[model samples]
Target: MEHLQPSLTIDFAQLSEAGRKDENQDTVGARFPEGPALATKGVAIAIADGVSSSSAARQASQTAVTAILTDYYATPDTWRTGQSASRVIHSINRYLWSQSQNNVRQEGYLTTLSLLVLKGDKLFTFHVGDSRIYRLRAGQLEQLTRDHNQRIDKNTTYLSRALGADLSLEIDMESLETERGDIYLLSTDGLHDFIDHRTLTEKLQSSSDLEALTHQLHQLALANGSQDNISVQIARVDDIGTPSESDAITVLSRLPFAPLLKTGQTLDGLTVEKILHESERSQVYLVKTVDGTPLVMKTPSVNYEDDAAYIERFVRESWIGSRLANRHVVRVVEPPQTRTCLYYLTEYIAGPTLTQVINERAPLPVSDAVELAEQLVMGIRALHRKDTLHQDLKPDNVVVGAQGICLVDFGSCWVAGIEEMASPIAADKILGTLNYSAPEYRYGGPTGQRSDQFSLAVLMYEMLTGKHPFGEAYGKAMSLPQFQKIKYRSALQFNPLVPVWMDRALEKALSIQPGQRYEVLSEWLQDLKRPNPNWLTNRHKPIMERHPEKVWKGLAFAGWAVAAGLLVFIATR
Candidate 1:
């Protein structure tokens, strides 16, 4: 719990009333998952309104609301907001439709369902039929979901899409970024249809207690002559628990910088043995504990002593490393007790960085390079699983130890939940090496797991061919036109040992557009080992398409030869 922070804290309330209807056919509920699930799955709120014409409408309303609220949490934490909620809605719709088919007299189970999931600082909305979800932010009321109803006249309308309306369901899903103090409202048609937007806005502004607001909305719906069951749910964002950038910078800046250590110099209980590495970023030293346990102590560069952002990044790097337990990631060791300075320690790996290895052994064996790439991808996959992007993924940030590959450097990491909070860090700033970074990162756009995959493929290309795909021009492009003009050189041109299929896979992963790359790191790793059949077709592509520069140069040479022959013929004449 000390290492991890809860991304969201919310207050929620739900109420359902029969109003003027003989039977209460509306259902509304909200639930916050416990412990780890709360952090991973967040909270879910749902409201459903049953159709008056169907005998099994009540069951459909209750079932739809219950199924989504419970099953949405059951989905894998790795799944994105849209995927998890959409899958649950589809499955519940199928069940409702099957029950309707089984009973002829009961007709079809029909209901309008609107569900909202608040995870971290994001809101996921899933809706079908006339029920609605709305959000109040910065004193403005915005309708977040669409009304799935067809109007024939002023007073006559029918639900166009609802649970069990047909064997197949069409659910409207959307995700919105959330801010602290944002209030969300989910309501059945009985409540939303009767209460106008102005009235709803007035009710929300008048109350601070969510329970009181829900009651007020229900009463107003009934007062306005709601003749059907009324149900409403209100959710207020209380807090996003992550620290702000300024707060983090302030806290980390207070720590004093560590002094350089000479061989055999003692600090606390660890004795420095040798200088491992040095850069403008930081210095690493090989050290030994009092009991002679080997370790690596990293101290921030003296140059950044007054730089708050740099200090904050260094501290965050240690925090991120401490949380990761993957074999291929460098392990950050916790201080035995309290530390005296800003430096952090890690379990030392007795090996050179991947950059050194690549330089020392150019054009590594095909199997060795592929195997190394697979291990490196595994490390990147581990970070991606936790919704973290190692923005600075390159050969220099990876170490080849006796055990295997170990990913280092988290100064440029972007954590999903943490980044959602108020931070001093600029989200749009380009991070990572230019040659390896994805094109999107260059333009100040959001980078995803795919961006990291781009970096990995670049490293793989370098390991195999000792050359960049687009050469130096790719990294120097300042505009979209310049970027688009950069050509990709085949790995086989540099090293003929690389298989055409493998080179094609690298080309796809190294696509200028992030969407053109592999969806997952594992997929690219698999392609490296076993060639994809789709890539086989790419091998037969025209020389101009596969290697544009080669064809262009050949055409230019032929044109020059023809021009020279014409000049000679004219001179002789």
Candidate 2:
């Protein structure tokens, strides 16, 4: 039996014309991709209407439509529809606003935009200004967007919100469940403002041919005395093609996991040179191609063969690694040949793990620690730019090579795009090693870029002190109260060579509350390299708090001297 792959299918048509204006200031576009792109990115339809008051209105509308159509597909497939569309729209708005600012005539580039995306069994809508999106399902017509316009009088009105109207844009977005046979309509104000809702609904219900229907709507708008550029777009859902959890599992498990390999054994044109590491979840191998080019191959363990969630995560790790390109992050490589089993390869890094380095050379020099910190931040920032979070940041996941430091593990990464998609697999209750994880993960609080900052700070403290920032009790602290009881052991206490300002920076990054941490990783790195004037005020604190061990030793010496004086006095008597 041949299995058919699930996919989203749609039929759409669009038309834009100058009804009474000298030039058309409305734009409409639709993209229907096939195969994997259709399944991942779905179908997109956008409509934009330029405000007539602006001289650059046509350009603004065209740019808004074109930017969303092209850039939306360029985003990582892991991102959800809203996240991807919103990012592209915001960028377009910024460009249009800048152009308007530079215009000598001061006529702003402004337009209303409405975007509709059909993915899986859902419809996602992004709207700004007075452009409207309507859906007809089960013989009922419903408007999915609100007009962003304010009226000075019954006959005069202006758009209250629009792209390029301001430096920052606030777009209205919504998601609704979709059904096959549902019809969606997108129209500019020129058409919707002139045609009544009842007449539009009646026309939509009476037409089956989308191309003719859109043309009909345009002519009707002009007949109704519309004095602006007119535009209309119509799309009908042919198939929902919703992928169930089992479908995801089936797709991911097409290739079987490879058995544990021995040295000198060949599979798929690559020979296993040595086993690098093995755990209950996965196996890492040092492999060489037929040409003797060395690489590292990671394969899922057979222990999770029946676990769909585990299999999805294992495959996702490879997918994420292949997309990231950074000098400070390990590069996932393509296989030398077609693979017969489930496994992925990466460029071989010739260096010890950060953990191994610490074991051999604890208390790394301040300069070396600072340099490594900068590299790590660079790598993590790359992931952050793509809306990814490296949930785990520890010495074991970092390799110190001659090329510099490279973050190596992606199994624990969290991608915002993927999270937005519907999934049958439950998320892990806790991600990353408990010792380096932030408190939010344990307490079920929201986690974001700040969570990674907390983990990075822990790594920095360990590099300078050869110990965890919260001591041995941190890893065991499971509850909020337990975490609260655990206090930070400053790096200076273990290595006096660490600067006071640098230690203070580490303390701030390692704050138990995520809000207390630096707003960005770069700020923390800056504080580490330079002294913060505010931290200098700590010098005025009581000496005992700053140097408790020194104070205790001095007190012990004084007590011994007093005892000796008493003994001498008694002997003389």
Candidate 3:
């Protein structure tokens, strides 16, 4: 069906081999909402190795695929090609986590997951355990997802991470720029054991016909005497993509930028000092205007690197930052476009990274952390009013600048652009960081302002306690998808500097379950200002961050009170 874009051909096959001692555990790929075609812009493929050790492995396999497929189809159209597929899988994570929680018989019903989503040929992949995504480009196959279970020694395969075991699990997301003739082969470790990429590519060479090729590949896996549930999905790009609707929606406007006089290598009549930061994709420079006004100038990574897609994204981000014009956000100003580059000038920030500050002090003083957190919440409120979500909010991205605490790094910010950015697979990958990512992110689908709140809670938690709730358990810094349920009670006992009110407040803000987190940044800010001993932190722990009720429940209840007041006055008269 050639309506517009080039036709992308996909073929998938799954098999249960006799050597594994598992029959019903094997499952195959099909579009969710139960259909043959994926209407959503990308193709979803996965290889789930159900726990052969568990009794309910068969049912677990079915549940995992169903959850993953449902998430793929239900993805909000707002995501862009810039994010990851791990987010969609996270949506699936909650489902599997909750399902296993209820059924005791399904105890330890875990699986190794390798998920690949294809958008215009770009591959977004996430993996846990050993399932793999391999790309056959120019006769070479590159293994994209790193296996959780590394070979600790030559003889043994030790598990680092796997699905179903943890209350929540993490999946990896990385971009693979695919070409038109490129071949992508996704398989379970069962298939990888016998047929390496060279053999797989050669076997796939004869079958240009999608379904026939899938069948031949499955037969080859069986011929190698593979033991386990084996699955393979093949996709040939066939065509390249230009830009999504969101990509075109970048903000384009000229604002008050000092552009009065310029001979060359200068903007707004300033002398061109030198380039600040430039790569193949973009360039930034530290320069001064004629009067010695210092400014940081940024342009596309390079003329070629500053291709249509990258430039548009950078433009969108910079434009959003300019319009936000918030104290906590870095102010962006437009620069006169020269014949060579589309330039942007901004206030040169003077600040250290929160990460760096944390490094220097080991941990911040409690009062300072709370003071800075309040400032961040206010900044977040401003961002929400502008309908922007700072997708990659991490300690490094935030600045404890001369201006107090300012948020930076809008590079992965999520908001509607002149074009659409929310590609199906990238649903949650764009906004926020690991350890702090919302449950909705890992599970997949539309993550809006509430997702930002989840990240906010992480920051706030760090403020109240000298440590990150999730990052603390591991001796190392922290792992992505940290599963420790944050407890304010535990934190308060560990640190004497924390206030009782803050302990409860932080508990509410940093609830691992979205339902429990503060629904509105303002609500939390209000509570912060009031310093209430009886703040409803614990009572409202299980709130759906996306639950509209948090926004409207008060108004609806107030409406009822007004009506009741009128009725009582009439009755008294």
Candidate 4:
């Protein structure tokens, strides 16, 4: 009772005659320890109903809840707010299902559940069986989680995707945005079937006393004829207040793991010479080895040892990038699996950002801009040939050195066909910049080479014209008319000097419908070879450094040393 008191925000009033066939099942249905580690904005709740036909349901429910909470808290840092909580729950479901199947007596021993995980302003809810999730916002009640019971002709009693009943599950992922004053309630069907949303909302609306409110809600569920076990996990969003500046540890240099990693200190034979960008993830530096070869060492921020998610992404991106043998994409060396808690290494290129290059040389001559586009397109095409999608393509991600444009940061790129791909920016899922994201990606679907192409087209337009096709106005460009009518075409009206073919090429690439646009990468190739280069001019002043060939030479040498040594050893053997 005390555990429920501090964690939840509800008041249960007095109970009357409730609709239940048995007297033993009249009380609230919850299995929890008195002491639970408090979460910032999440509720660790577990619930189960004892099957009328089997005695194993009680033990099954308790074991199921305990296992779920154990794994939920044990989650690595890589499992953060953006990931699907349903995936986590579904994992639990599989465990519970397998456990229930091993014993014959517990054959039908199963409990329905609805679990809620709230971290910060993000809410992830997963429900199996008849349990539910309720949200009371703006004084209006909304039942967010749906029930699985499938009663024949009438649609009431039987259900699908419950534990111990089947092997796999089709879980519904109910994700929502939360504010400071929102109220969330998670309970079983016993509580929901009896209490209506309007009545629940009225009792749960922000009140001076929550204990009294909780008692009131409890009494009402009992009064409504609740059969089976009843339980509630109510969470009220409270302001934890902001962290002070002193709370933040400033990172301006390489993160040292042990005694010291200072300037001139060499790691893995590479001397730490200069610091690049330092942040919460890693301390990037321009490091050189004993042989006078320079490389970029991304030493993990001290935060990495504390945050598992950052480590996962850093390791994943580094490993994936290293296997790729392409000129345009920055190469990562060393096996990612061998990476320590301290740092990962990558090939360094001294060049200006495409964003900077375009800034200085906007409105490039038709021929040169086309050449840049050709390289960019071919680089992307090579990556695609390997079935990789550069989910995040922007001026920042593209490096313009002496050789050509080098795409940096495979952090958001993925193996093309995975379901849970990382987004490029902070807005929505299926990640990429808001101005460049495809309509399908913003919704919900596996974004492939085509979607990446759309982003490339946007960046191409920006590179040529020094302006975004959608610009800042596209944030509000969610309306159908804004997308279908007033986008890239208007840019042509702004600069009539842009050829009709170039304008139309950009328009076609930026098409709202993916299939309607260029169905082939060859289309981008065609655009790159087009005669009019003013579409994206390359004549801006000196944005990039004078030397790009130096980097190409270094990479070439690194490759030969490894290859020549292999050949010599083989010949000797």
lDDT of each: 0.82, 0.88, 0.61, 0.60
Candidate 2: tens digits of C-alpha lDDT, residues 1-573: 001124667888888998898999999999987765675677899999998898899999999999999999998876778889999999999999999999999978999999999876778999999999999998899999999999999899989999999999999999998899999999998899999989989999997999999989989888899998889999999877656767767877789889999999898999999999999999999999999999999999999998877777777788788889999989999898998899989999999999998888879999999999999999999899878899989899999999899999899999866665545567654379988899889877778999999999988888888998988888887777888898988788899999988989999999888898999999999999999888876463689878899999999999999999999999999
| TM-score, model 2 to reference | 0.87
In model 2, which residue pairs have backbone atoms overlapping below 3 Å? Answer: 79-417, 80-417
Error of 2 at 156 (Å): 0.8
Clashes within 3 Å, all models in order: 2, 2, 37, 34
RMSD of each: 6.5, 5.9, 20.5, 19.9
lDDT of 4 by residue, 1-573 (tens): 011112323222222122454433222332232322232224444555544455666555656566666666554222332242455566756766786777776556566666665543456676677777788777778888777767777644665656656667776666676666777776666677788866777777746465566566667777776655556666666642222222211221123342235678866677778877665545778888677878887765665454434444554566557657789888887622433335667788889988788889876665666677777777787677655777888787788888988887776665531212222212212365676666556555445678877887777676667787876776556545566655554445545566666776777777777776777878766865574454444332132333457667888999999999999999999
Scored by TM-score, the top model is 2
Better candidate number, 2 or 4, judged by lDDT: 2
Compare the candidates by lDDT and give the number of the best one. Answer: 2
Superior by TM-score: candidate 2 or candidate 3 = 2
| Number of backbone clashes in candidate 3 | 37
**Candidate 1, position 533, lDDT:** 85
The alpha-carbon deviation from the true structure for residue 344 of candidate 3, after best TM-score superposition, in angstroms, is 32
| TM-score of every candidate | 0.72, 0.87, 0.45, 0.46
Instruction: After the best TM-score superposition of candidate 4, give how far the Cα of residue 363 lies from its true spot, in angstroms.
Output: 32
Q: What is the lDDT of residue 479 in candidate 2?
A: 74
